[model samples]
Target: MIKDFNEVIKSRRSVRFFLGKNIKTSIVKECIKNATLAPNSSNLQLWEFYHVINDEIKINISKSCFDQPAAKTANQFVVIVTRKDLWKNRRDFNLNFIMNKFKDLKDKKSRRKKKNAVNYYKFLIPTLYGNFLKISGLIKYLNVSILGLFRPMYRQVTSSDLRVVVHKSAALAAQNFMLSMRASGYDTCPMEGFDSVRVKKLLNLPGSAEINMIIGCGLRSEKGIYSEQFRVPFEEVYFEK
Candidate 1:
């Protein structure tokens, strides 16, 4: 087991080449379960993972990716998907969790806190997540922008903005999955080069769902490390508060 967190992080790389050795699907699934521990916006958890190991499915997916070496040669694959259309369902889930959790508490302060949280899921969430086309979002944006001129306001209200929110959450889950894989002595390469439309069809996903990233999974081959790792100087990207 990889006990050193630092080593696990440092050892992870986009492995484009993989050995022929087989990896246990159950291990990968456990890694995915670990992925659910990642933080997400609104606790909505608007992500899904598809573990693709079937040979026929893998071949088709690789073709959708233009047979890129990263995907074409990998032993297995995990497709991260964002389901923004399920906002209401997720909101309800949170609400249900809150209700069940707070139902037994008798303290007045706890009751007040529960009421506030209930209102958040019942009213505030619907206000933000309930939108049609871009019309509602555009109106909310203009209203919020004007309000912000006077006082602090939550500005990310547009439909596009919400889409980005879902994508960001999915990315967090993807990173969690990758790190967990690394901790398990597996290799991965996250790729967005695939035809998302075809990939979704192959997976039988609805049009409302979006493919966040496809991660190739296996043990690294001799040629896996294509080049020396490089990054911009820390001083260039770092900032002092």
Candidate 2:
């Protein structure tokens, strides 16, 4: 049975050890499917998930992760990746999708909406993502800074900034994947302590691709959780307008 949303959130822990019991590959795939529904920047969807089920590959990945207990004991691994290099392809995909959706609408309001969406993918995205050896981004950043002095302007135009944006989206999807796994009566531990170079070579990922996180997945062992959850204090973190 699926779990309630609050229960799923509260129950999730950074499981350090998992039982030898195996989890269903199909169920993990379903959780990944749910992950894709996560909201992203401009709907670019510049992310990929690698479900490492093969024992050989999983072992190599665990080695890359320094064979931490979470990595060594988990039944499987899910690697989330950010593909900032694929911006053009994703831009065209959204462009085509939006165009197709609005193709049949001839009303004035519909046409205006279509034009705005079309221009966003066609013009704005290219301007933001089409950097020439980082020069373009620098120029765009300077331009935005100058314009911002006079009026409110979008500023995060540098290549590094965009990379952060893509990774943030991937991390959001990773959270969704973990929560979905919890809801399905499974567990996961998101691990960043890995050799990105080795993991990329193992996965045959390109240089422009980035490893967001590698999640260890399975049924948590009795001693999987190290300690009770801790927090500074809700009042310290929460604020009101």
RMSD of each: 1.0, 0.8
Most accurate candidate by lDDT: 2
Worst 10 residues of 2 by lDDT: 130-139
What TM-score would every model get versus the actual structure?
0.98, 0.98
Can you write out model 1's per-residue Cα lDDT over 1-241, one digit (the tens) per residue?
A: 7659999988899999889889999999999998888999989999999999999999999999899998888999999999999989999999999999889999999999999999998998888889866589989999999999999999999888989999999999999999999999999999999899999999999999999999999999969889877899999999999
- Model 1 residue runs over 4 Å out of place are 132-134
lDDT of 2 by residue, 37-98 (tens): 99999999999999999999999999999999999998999999999999999999999899
10 residues in a row with least lDDT, candidate 1:
125-134
lDDT of each: 0.93, 0.95
